[model samples]
Target: MINRRNMLRAGVVAAGVAGGVAVAAGPASAAASGKGWVSVLDHYRDAQGQERDDAGAIQAAINAATAMRPVHSVLVPPGEYVVNREILVSGLNDAVISGHGATLTLTGAAATTPGASAVLKITDSERFEVSGLTVVDNERTQPYNGVSIARSSRGTLNGVSVYGVKWTGLGVFDTTPGASTDIAIINCTAVGTRFGISTNGHDVRIIGNHVAMYWPSTAEAAAKGGVWSAPSDYYDGINVLTGSDRTTVTGNTITECGQAGVYTQDCTNLVVSANTVTGCQLRGIEVDGGSRVAVGVTVSGNTVVDCKGQINLVRARDVSVVGNRLANTSAARAASLIAVNVGSSHVSVVGNHATQAHPTFPAVYVIGDATDVTVAANEVVAGTPYQAPASVALLYRSAAGEFTVGGRLLATKGLGVGNAVAAATPGKVVSKIEVFSASGASLGFVPVYQSIA
Candidate 1:
């Protein structure tokens, strides 16, 4: 067995001609590039051989790069690097693992403790980056993440692809303090994994990623992928778990999932904007409270299609679902376009255009005792009728709901243009809302109104 002492004690290995690896400029320049980069092949070999794993060689290359100053990048060129265990990069600062056209495939080696296994793990590192890599998880069983960054600061995983894992594909976390935490996971792809992208960190950016290939709910689908912590998480796409703050999930495409596309629980000051979510069996976006209270979440400027439940907020506060376009197909399963359930306060479902497929489910459902709720402006109507007088909303237990946010409603002008909603509870006094008409009358009978101020 080749140990770490033996791997690092030996000098840099030269790229031999028998290796059959691709090198651009020649062996001398690639083996030890004095100009800020070194090839992993300089210390690794026999990746194609099944008898020996390339884990030790790859670890050696990374160790060499990190230990030697100015040689900060370990370039893994176009080849398969078979790894049996986690390639741990701890306290690695100002380094890069450039694997643009390379594959890091995990071998079918059974781990004694699969709970502590990952293909690549960057922990307690600063200003480190791993980009343009394809990580294939062939661990033969469950309980392994593809790439995970924990307790790290300013770490980035850009343009990476993770495939075939029962656990998280790309995960970022802030376990402890002392490190300045800011992470970015941009333009990544996760397919056939349990959780496409799971994060519970502050100051994180999850942008322009594609999450698909695992759909759990339908009978036609094979498997599921989703939230890492909760029991309800079956096949989630982008799950931001508890206590994450100042996070941004924008311009991503989440599709074909059993559960929520973008699910945020107990997160504060978060923004979910300009994303496209489609073909999710559950909600396109869900903002709910967990152990902590969820607040200041903005779900704006999104396009969602063919999702059963579009946007949902449960027991949340200071949340806004604004300027989004949600639509469903004619054969879509029945679900609400927007749902604001009990314990939600200071919530505004404003300036959104929602079109539902099934007439049974309303476009907007304000259920139970939500306080200071506002459903104003824009259009919410049935898609099949096309701007007809449709059952646009249902306000249940709204009249008896209390007012926790102490304030007056916005001065009502005329019922604005494109206000195409009919409250389903005819003759039910809807009084809990804060909005007031220009005639000093409470728009209480959110009951039979065709439009709203």
Candidate 2:
């Protein structure tokens, strides 16, 4: 969150700027329109055609915005803009660039080149905005990143659509880690990219976006030796990683990503809630601690559907996965739908509903020396999209930790075992479910293998 002092500081822009015959002064169309505006056509009229590069004209419009006093907006209005070179918007204060009915097409020598491949970059600024733009690639043979925001603060991207990027569609970062604050990306659509949105800044909000087709095509995957993102495992739909603090990803419909739908790692205080995730090739939602283990993560109220691998928390701590709905989960790479593995601690998988589960594996699995994991009060239904036979158990904990499954269910028969429970409740794996004790003891018999469908 940016304070009042931060907002006031962002209002400072250098004065005494000018534009040429192709550009004009900005007009405040309404209360919603910005105080200052600069039209790119007023600066360079020949920039409208796709036959030539428009980077100079576009950059000039942005410069003119800052050159004007209290007029801080640039418009790439209602036309096609072809760019061969990268267009830069750098070192500004309190500015907006809107392109509601415009399209920016990138051509010639456009492909992923680490930090220099983005079509547009907003760097080293404060209180900046870019909204309502469409960015696409001209060459299907090669593509680059869509927009990159680096070392900026109090910035926003709203209602933007980006496609045909190979590396990252929308990326926000700071060279100095954790130095950025109060950035928001709202209602943006990213498609056909390796990573939809990758961020490592502070206090960022990624909300209400439609992101899909984030995996490489079959030919592209074969080109990488039958793997997805081999050199870099960053093909997720929305990635929050590395020094990101107070990040919130909510209310987005994410689909068909190669890695995970919403992936988080090496961050702090993340909240991934109310997102609909589906058709992911790997884990639907993964909180993997890649190097610097993420602390204070919460994944709640998301609907994960039919993903090959479901929600997994690997090497993370202080996490809560609650009130999530998982449906028709399929097992992939021998991992269950809900898995907490690899030395993860203080995790709670509580109050979740696993409906119509096709249990090729156990519905819930806590493995790999995980400690202090509680799988409680979950309603897990096996086999049957309400249709047929349900196989496998409700839970499996193969860890060396203190695990508890509260609410013992009612067994039809008294098949006594070493870790037997006095079956007293009714209606399936209800009240509580504990298949094995911490000391490798069986808690029940016949009903342990019984279908709760």
Candidate 3:
């Protein structure tokens, strides 16, 4: 087995007569002026009358390209290239390792460990393009991430199929403190992993990808930290964080994860729209911790069903959650509470619908030191058997917090008895109650106003 780091540093040559011809120009100046293509099969030959192409021989070819002119293409032709160790596809500048209808299938022989099976490990290469190939990492000891891209500027993973990887199909992480900018994933299929596309890059766009997660059992959920941790390696399903900015998660179907479908933490300027999330064990979407720290995010136009909780926003600021539908398609556990909780201020939860709340829980629960939270234009029509509306529609239990609820349809208590502010003292000023609901409502004039009058 070749040490990937040493092979990368030694500069592997592309295999074959065409590769040797290309290398005859010397790896350094082969295509310094124009473009070049390095094919993997060109390096393979019958070793001791064996029929299969040798993995080490292929690695030697890739090793020779280390100091080659910016690789215009690192082509892997259609065939099963069995690897004994992980392959590092590293270089700098607008390089492309295109598979051009080639199948870079990961063989089961490399099942030495979780880290040894990945077909391609991309690093520090900008404007990288990987497409039209099938990468399979068949390891059951742990989930194998298909392609790992890091610190690469403007990376693209398009029309790629990743099979039998554990944690994620496509993963981009900023292991270095330095920021990775402008990553895009389009038209990809990731199966048999915890998450399809897992990213932690700035200006990331995850569009038009079919991402499916493994159906986790209760034990798997707990071991993997719950359904909210879908794509369950560390934190699943596009875990973008650390002040990464401008992430758009749109038009993707994310289902059956251990945790939240879309986990955006500490991001500046984020948007989750036109995405359908279902059968997730935990919250459907979680936007956490971007106060003044990570500002300007919106979660809109999403349909989430059968999730433990629809949405959980904590310590976020300037967030607009509108035009979303939350429904419980499962009868086992109640749909978890939908909340904009703790340290979050100036949030607008309008034009959203929630159904099937827990008997004792409200559809939308607001907690923590949140102030100026607006709950308006929402419809909470309780589930069957009880037409009396969700617990109170909205619960504001934070001490010293101000909430404004209006333009909502409620079937139960308009101003829930225990949730109202205590009556004002003789000279102190108090917030007033306002009700704007349809006529013929039972709680039109709440039977009891639990105020300290």
Best by TM-score: 1
- Over 1-453, each residue of candidate 2 has an lDDT whose tens digit, in order, gives 221111211112222122111222343222222435665655554445432237667777777676666646786666577777678787656667777666788767444556456888888777777778888864644446788788888888888899876678898877666776778888999987778998999999999999997455556666786566655434689999888889999999998787789988888899999999987777889998888687898999999987765788888899999999987534344435677878687888878887544545666767747766767667666532111112212232224553332233334454322334445545453233345444445564444423645
Clashes of each: 4, 11, 29
Measured over all alpha carbons after superposition, the RMSD of each candidate to the real structure, in angstroms, is: 9.7, 11.1, 10.4
| Superposition TM-score, candidate 1 onto the true structure | 0.75
**C-alpha lDDT score of every prediction, in listed order:** 0.70, 0.70, 0.62
lDDT per residue as tens, model 1, 168-223: 78988555422335888999999877678988887889999999844644323532
- Between prediction 2 and prediction 3, the one with superior lDDT is 2
Show where candidate 2 strays beyond 4 Å.
Answer: 1-35, 45-52, 110-112, 140-143, 214-234, 329-335, 356-360, 383-453
Q: Look at candidate 1 and tell me the lDDT of residue 409.
A: 35
Candidates in order, TM-scores: namely 0.75, 0.74, 0.70
lDDT value, candidate 3, whole model: 0.62
Q: Considering TM-score, which of the candidate structures 2 and 3 is the better prediction for this target?
A: 2
**What does the lDDT read for residue 344 in candidate 1?**
82
Off-target runs (Cα >4 Å) in candidate 1 are 1-30, 45-52, 112-115, 138-140, 174-180, 214-234, 383-453
